[model samples]
Target: MYFTDRGIEELTARRGDESVTLEWVSDQLRTFVDLHPEFETPVERLASWLARLDDDELDDE
Candidate 1:
């Protein structure tokens, strides 16, 4: 999911209050997959990383 700036802002707003919806998570994961086409590791690793909230979790962050 290639998020437009609006999409990203919407997601950030939803996540900020710790009220994350499944849709937001799904969108973010899809965005990651779209951004990193050369990912060699398992998708599970990616999923695991996506499930986390740590500051150092995502490379783009």
Candidate 2:
């Protein structure tokens, strides 16, 4: 997914000093999907898959 500077800043702020959790990141991705349902298949599938991955898995990506 593409992130604007503001979006990245917001995410960074939310992430704070602690490592981000998969569940938390997934919730953000789900909200993004809910807001933008018109995106193509693989993007949707990827987002869904990302929602299921462990935090370390996501971090590695």
Candidate-wise lDDT, in order? 0.69, 0.72
Clashing pairs in 2: none
Q: Write the per-residue lDDT of candidate 1 for residues 1-61, one digit (tens) a residue.
A: 5657787789688866787677877787677777885663555575777577575646566
Mind giving the per-residue lDDT tens digits that candidate 2 earns over 10-41?
Answer: 86898667887778767776777678877546
What is the overall TM-score of model 1 with all chains considered together? 0.37
Best by lDDT: 2
Instruction: Name the weakest run of 10 consecutive residues (lDDT summed) in model 2.
Output: 39-48
lDDT of 2: 0.72
Best-fitting candidate, scored by TM-score: 2
